[model samples]
Target: MSQFKIRGGKPLKGDIVPQGAKNEALQVICATLLTPEPVTISNLPDIVDVRKLIDLLAALGVKITPHSPNEYTFQADTIDIDYLYTDDFRRRGAALRGSVMIVGPLLARFGKGYIPKPGGDKIGRRRLDTHFDGFIKLGARLRGNPGENFYGVETHSPLQGTYMLLEEASVTGTANILMAAVLARGTTTIYHAACEPYIQQLCRMLNSMGARITGIGSNLLTIEGVTSLHGTTHRCLPDMIEVGSFIGLAAITGSDITIRNAGVPYLGQIPSVFRKLGITLHIIGDDIHIPPHDHYEIDTFMDGSIMTISDAPWPGFTPDLLSIVLVTATQARGSVLIHQKMFESRLFFVDKLIDMGAQIILCDPHRATVIGLDRRQPLRPATMSSPDIRAGVSLLIAALSADGTSIIQNIEQIDRGYQNIEHRLRLLGADIERIP
Candidate 1:
């Protein structure tokens, strides 16, 4: 295991080009199994999760060739579908939550698919019931052993598209059902579908591969099943979550940083949400430039009351950035409520912030009220451990901008998302080192 030892209180300044979206890359890679032709993907973030997914794909007999660095061509012409029953498949597949998505394509192409319970962050209870419900709605029968934590699906007939409303806006669940719906016999009308950028990218990629899909950015999606899908080249979009992380990093550390190649259109409600926190972004071409500033003030509600920033479905502030926003709010002047409505346990990380001397009220498992210090007293650094991906990065941000040296363990969680995070921060003048 490795840990990061950071010396805080230095302003990070430089240019950072965001990596390709990890969520989009995961879905796109799985889409390769829909066809036997070569599907090439470029600008993929070289993160641990992506690499693990690649390993899982290779195990399934997908021929993944590296055309160049950060680019690969995936061919599933000789897939070993039986590998899904192996112990290796179950262990590795359960490592990341996104691994559950492989079931859709595998079941669609082959007649059977098997998967263990998927694992990722422990932020809240992520139910796979909706995914199973979607599969059942499409004519697949599922049987699982509760003691073994293993699941299996088998279907002899082709999946029949039907009208179904998702219980909640589950991102991976939407992608799984979307993939399955593409090869079904009829039109699949999905209401309450997750229309996040990753899901939209998956839909667009499927359309590019000859699957007819409409309602790209809406809660309701219509997908027309095609006989077969052909492979094509698709580039993954820039990770807006990472872009938001950089924005928070710049503001809290009082740095001037430029994030290049950021997909501005995909950053729905992000810029405006941060602007309410008094963080300014200068748009120059495709780059978002954040200038240096010592103090930031929180914007109040229209009634001249304390403001609140919360997460919702697409076109709303992203839940992924709530942790970053909480850390940024600690350095701003005034008070704001950070409401994370999606996940119940996400607010538990505020205890670490309180340990650093920031004023925070942990109202419940889903909400937190932050009163910014306005740089009055430097946050006292302490030893900490990363709990999850987003919370891990938020802790790193707090540590980097704190008063003294801090050590953060369990950095593998951070590696699963961010690409070369320590090196990137080092380039931006942050005193961070990785110790093994």
Candidate 2:
């Protein structure tokens, strides 16, 4: 395994262009299975997760031809459905949560699909019930052994659209059902759907491939099932979560960094959320610029009370950035409540920060109150292990700004999403090294 040895107390300064959204790219690649023609995708992030998904697709006989480093054309015309049932694909498919999306398209096209338990961050109980529920609504019957970590789905006939009020606004669930609904016999109305920018991009890509979808940016989505779909070229959106991560890194490390190609339209509540934690950002055209500051103070309410930052469904503050915000708040001058309402275990990482001289009150599994020291007391660096993708980046930021050298293990978790993170940090003047 490789580790990152970072010497802190350095201000990072440079320009960084964020990679394509890994979340969106996964779903878009799976959408290729819905058609027989070639679907070209551009601006693809050369990350571990994307490469794994592409390998899974190639194993299933999806012809993939690389036109460039970050571009590829995938043709599912010659797919061998049986390849998905093999042990190798099943084991590899479980490596990422995005792989679960293949079940919907596979079932829709081949009348059957099999998948092992999907794997991802161990944040909390990420159930696949919502995904299966969508499939059942689309005329699929699912069955699997209780103790077994596999699922099997078979459809008696072509699916007919039905209205479904999703129990939760699960992003992958929405993507799964959206793909299944595209080939259904009738119109499907999905209430309480996830309307995040990534989901909206999936809908737009599906539309370009001859699927009719309305309510692109809302919780209620109406998908008119089509008999078939063709091929199209799609450019993945710039990753907003990475943008937020970089923003937090620049602030905590006292760096002046500019993030290029950041989608300004999708960063609706992000800047304001950081602003509450005393992080100021400037949007120069399509780029977000974060300048260096010696001391940052958290903003309080008009009633002269502490402010709180939390996550909700789409258009609300993203849950993915809560860890980043919590880490950034450690250097700010006031107290703020960081509530991670979506996951139970996400707040556990704060304990590591507290050990490094941060004043954090772990209210519960879902909430924590952070009192910023305003960079007064230096944090003593220590050995740390990455827990998840977002938390891993947060810890890296903390390590980069700490007083001494620190080692972070399990960097593969960070590589799953962020592309060339060390290289990007180097460009920003961070003294981070990758050690094998």
Candidate 3:
């Protein structure tokens, strides 16, 4: 096991470039399966999840060529359909939740797909029914063997496009259906679809590859199926969640950092949400410049009610950054409510923050009330375990602002998403070391 030993109370200073978006990378990489021509991608994040997906694609016989540190070319000229049944497929497919997305593209290209039970963070009851149901709605037959713990999709005839109203605006579900719909025959209309930038990027990439899709950034989408798709080059946007985390880190640790190539146009409502927490950000060109602040005050409602930060769909606060928001609130001058509506178990990490001397009330599984310390009292350092990716980074931010040294185990969770995180933070003068 690997752990991080961090000494607190040091201000980080420098320009940090945000890595390519991980969520977008997952969707875009899987889109490569939709075409047999070469699909060249740049600005790919070098994270564990992406590496695993690339390995799985190779196992399925996709020709992958590395061009540079953050660029690759993939050509799925021929694929071994039978590889999906091997033990190697089961082990690798179960290692990452993103692996499930491969089924959609495979079903479109080869008329069949299979995957073992997918694994990811145990945040809540993340259901796969949306994906399976969407596939079935598009004329694919679904099969599952519970005794073997495997799921499969097949269709004798070409998928016939039809209208589908998604149960929820599930991100992965939308990506899967969109991939499957591209090769389907006839027209497909999707209502109440996810409008996140990731989805928009996938649509644009597919369109560039000759799939006709309308409604780029809205809930209603119209897709005209194409018999085949070609190849194209795509560069993903910067990781917005990482940008928000850096903003919170600067506020909590009194650091001044500039995040370059932040894709400011795509970061919807994030800067305003952080501004509500009294953090100062200067938008310099395409970068976000966060200055040092010893204290930040949480804004209350206009009627003197407590301020509440909640997550919603895109153009609202991101659920991924609620943990950072909760940690940033710990040092603010007033109290605020952190309401996580999407996932039930994400707020349980507050117990670890409370152990570090923050005043927090776990109202329930979905909400937490935080009373800030106003920087008068410093949080005491303690050893902790990372439960998930976002929580792991939240704990690291807390440790950097605490009184003494802290040890955090299970850092692999953080590495699965963030690339060389400790090394990146070290460039900004943070006192962090990784040990195995």
Each model's TM-score?
A: 0.98, 0.98, 0.99
Q: How accurate is candidate 1 locally (lDDT)?
A: 0.91
lDDT by residue (tens digit), candidate 1, 282-392: 988789999997998999998999999999988788899999999999989999999999999988989999999999999989889999999998788989999999999
Quality of model 2 by C-alpha lDDT: 0.90
Q: Could you give candidate 2's per-residue lDDT for residues 1-436 as a string of tens digits?
A: 8999999988888899989999899999999999999999999999999999999999899999999768999999998987866889878988988899998898888888888898988799898899999999889998887588999788989988999999999999999989999999988999999999999999999999999999999999998998899999999999889989988888888888999989988887988888877787999899999999787889999998889889999889999999999999999999999989999999888878888899999999999999899889867797989988888989998999899999999999999888989987887778899999
> Residue pairs in steric clash, candidate 2?
none
Error of 3 at 166 (Å): 0.3
Model 2 scores worst on lDDT over the 10 consecutive residues at 81-90
Reference-based lDDT, each prediction? 0.91, 0.90, 0.93
Candidate 1: minimum summed lDDT over ten consecutive residues — where? Answer: 106-115
In the predicted model 1, the residue pairs found to clash are: none
Any runs in candidate 1 off by more than 4 Å, and if so which?
none
